[model samples]
Target: MVEQGKEQETKDFHPAPVWLDESYLEPLLRDLKKDPGLRITELEIKPATAKGDNYASVMTRVKILFLRSSAKIPEIEYYIVKTTYENDPFASDIFSKYQVSTTEMLMYEKVLPQLSALIEETRQPEKVFAATLHVDYEHDAIIFEDLAVSKHVLADRLIGFDLEHTRLALRKLAKMHAAAAVLNERKPGILTKFDHGIFNRYTKGFAPFFENLCDVAADFAATCPELGDHYARKLRELRKRVMEYSARVYDPQPDEFNTLVHGDFWVNNVMMRYGERKEPLDMILIDFQFCSWSSPAVDLHYFFNTSVQKPIRYEHQEELVQYYHTVLVETLKDLKFGGYTPTLRQFVLQLERGGFFAVTVALTCQAILTNDQTADADFNALMKDDERGRNFRKVLYHNKTLQENLKYMLPRFDRSGLLDVID
Candidate 1:
């Protein structure tokens, strides 16, 4: 049976913590003071941009009072705190069932240092992707950094983009992939030590949930006669393929082109502040819970399918692929002593590999995309909403948007020799 607060329905649930309790705040303050004489006088928690199953997070602003020998010195204010929680939600019952929470804390203590070091080494101090773990072991709470103040980007808002913005963003992605690739090569043993058992455990239970969700979508579609058949057929196909597709696409083994991927690299996970009306000032990436070692193509394909608008995709698919490839090659050369660039033929081959994965991504994301509710809605709601119900009905009966996306994608893949590999 699910735990009271741990039900899947409450997965997206985040209750605000308006006031900071001294019992919880004291231990964390002690930890922060170990480095210096910073005393936190005020603590406030507000909603953060991301969410996960184990923890509810918020931005924390800390006002510090510093003791001074000099009269000129005054109180200092600084902001730093991160999502803090135990990993009890992730531990298996078979592992010390009675001491589950204790065991979870021990595991986090072991892993936290290595994870922190890796984040510090790879990312800029200001742009670190990994959350710092300020474990207040005594109180069972953690305090670290508030990412929103330093770096964060919104998901739903679409600002205008031109060719230059597209090129630079692709370059940044290439740099990320190259850095991961070099790390994997240089420290093969160390990198391999990080386990993906958590993903396997979470997704194993989630398979049945996804099937039920597809069924829910189909049931909703049935109420609308005109679109019912269409949605029913599409959901049926999705149900049949979901498991098989996941298995093939989620391989964790390392290859030359496989690197650390932002598994859900869509528009929402990326943040951009605009300079004027159309130009972007900076792009900040968030949500590292789904991040793992995977094919670089997965990240590239996801960005193309979900982030870029339809008009841009239809017109610029080939050019965009080439541009991303160019950046990837350049980045690898800089990161490695004598990294060899793929030939045009080899580049095209990699892009084909990306297209193969795109089929599964595009189909699954369609349920979220075309649904009337915001795409960011919880998975269960996406499955149950009536407008999505109507949309699914139309898809099942008429096969409109899915057909169009596939028709547009397949020709590009075929022309580029991707279909031959798929067949």
Candidate 2:
């Protein structure tokens, strides 16, 4: 939620967070003071500027005041607070379960640290993840160092990233996956706690967001009735096929080549850093809410299909896929992985099985992209008009990017036999 115009002068928060309020604030401050390193004096909380975030996000901005001394530290520290409340109305009706939320904090508290250690031990230049400051067991909230204030800037979801951006992102992804593999190899069973895939859980229990996306795709395809019939028919049928088959996306037979996947890997979830020449420099992946165990191709197909546009994809699909596989193999081997890398054939099959997810993600992402209702709506504004918090089903059917990709990808997916209903 975008917090604007609600910055109060005192500790009395404007529409205080559901779990964190004045009562919790004082003690939380006290807890920090327990550490000799942190002699905090005051705190200021407000809504952070959230635009084009997940529909279920409830973010808060915190300003920490430290006691000034010879410690020679910056007096103010800023944090971005992320929480998924159990009783959130939208979360309840749409994405009711937040097992993903718990796992994300776990990943930060445990998984990511191990991964970072491996990266440093292996002397890898690529950075896999971001930094987290604090997490509350009771409030279901996590505080992260505010990267926004630094060279890091949010990736524009509407425009998406280009080839250079894609390569760097893939390298980072490989490092992360390899770290997990090595962590499991060294300790054995460290990642078991996150064995349940978040996408799998949501696909099974929540509303079929895919159907709504297919509905929009069908409508978008109907723009040219003659040429659109195949796409429209394919899309309409895809609605049913998607729900029934998508659950298997999380499953790979007998755990052949499973690794932890960043379930929500797309342009929006990444924050890109830029060099002075305006070239892509580095990135930090955010919104860890959906991290879980799955095939590496799950992340690959998602970014390649939805984020990479058709022209670039058509030109470089095989090369790009090979690049990702090569990096994954090299990174894992460097860390002395006990298991051999998945065969290229197996990776291709993973892409084939998981390609359907890209289709739905393409639809849902473009829907939210085209939908203006909340795209630009501010936090306080949504609070004032609760109707602004509607689902992505205001489904904008005529989105140009959506149409262009579908015209090309829908047929490709059909040819690859990814969409079972079409055949």
Candidate 3:
């Protein structure tokens, strides 16, 4: 009976793996043959590097060996295959409940194709980084091109981004936002069709998590009170404000420039391929999981809050925000919409409200960024016990730097009289 109980416990607690079964391979291969009109002989699959907030699915590259009627073509070539497990928490449910996978598939099938065609028509020769979708329904899988070899460029670390790359990224973001703005204006029906219930769920659910993270920050501060006191106060205040902010629905104010933001716009999501001698390549934005119609300033605020180092925030805060705004205006001009130029006053209000939201996200994400990725541990192991000491140290270090930066930026918002405006 004891042995039986132990076995039952094991079965009950077992977690699903990131990758799906290899059994799904044959159907995908069959689908590829049918879709691409390629005569496939053999296919090999292997794990590929997972990127961009991906915790639920493992991506793999598939090597396809095929024969072509034309003799000039290569016989054995590889293509990337992305597959996801059906039982993943992020996967779709039977009742059409909230699921990131389901939402993404919906966006790809219904939303993205129309956007892609429109973008192509408007801006010829300057292609957006849109992934092709292939659903293998029999195997419950999907496959697409590996963006790594293509125009995509992932800036893994933010330690070495020069001004040029930063400028390029901002400009690309602007163009994307501008295109989205134009689309919303031209086709309000398309914008209205998206289910924003997921966003509401996120904003609502995030507050308590942020409060818990603040408690972690406070605990970290207690370890080195003298060194971390200022940051601890800042984090506590930020947590309180974020909780209040999250409760309010994000209604786009009239005359505000709304756009379909690449809601997750950190350095990692942008993939770039450089020219000869490391010149700037095209910026390919990926991971549309959180893409939504919101104030474009949200993207600008989020990118700066997450990507730019803490030290740079104090020194170049104004310059960075101004750069984003300038690019936004230029991109708007390109789209022939001069009426919606985002003012400094409006940007400051966004900073206050959007900055609160960003700080919460940053605090939650800090644990992932600072932890030892290779450690054989669960969430409790990393976040609880003596391991918490090491994690606390990392958080304290970042908290100090981030708090110092916020101290400098926050007062600017107050002085500009935008604090009251945002709320």
> Which candidate leads in lDDT?
2
lDDT of 2 by residue, 1-423 (tens): 235434331222223376665455545554654643445567677765355455455667777777544456547767778776455555443343547667778887777877887887664655667787678867777877777667788666667778898888888887788778778778876774564454564435443455655665777777754347777777788777675565567664554677778877877777888989889888888777667667776687677765665655779777778788888887787788987478778777767667777676665655654343444332222222233322334325445666666667777777776655633
**TM-score-based ranking:** 2, 3, 1
Ranking by lDDT: 2, 3, 1
Off by over 4 Å in 1: 1-13, 17-37, 50-165, 193-203, 208-235, 252-256, 276-278, 337-341, 354-356, 369-376, 379-423
Write one digit per residue (lDDT tens) for candidate 1, span 141-219: 3444444454344534233235555555665576566566566666664433332321232344345334554554455
Runs off by more than 4 Å, candidate 3: 1-38, 50-53, 68-77, 83-98, 117-125, 135-142, 151-153, 158-160, 193-209, 222-234, 237-244, 247-251, 310-312, 337-341, 370-423
How close is every model to the real structure, measured as TM-score?
0.64, 0.84, 0.72
Give the C-alpha miss distance for residue 351 in model 3, angstroms.
3.5
* Angstrom error at residue 367, model 1: 4.0
Over the stretch 86-183, how does candidate 3's per-residue lDDT look in tens digits? Answer: 55332323113423455455565666666565555543325555576475444444556667656455665434245666777777776677666766
Off by over 4 Å in 2: 1-42, 49-51, 68-74, 85-87, 93-98, 195-198, 201-203, 369-395
Pick by TM-score: 1 or 2, better one: 2
Instruction: Locate the minimum summed-lDDT window of 10 residues in model 3.
Output: 89-98
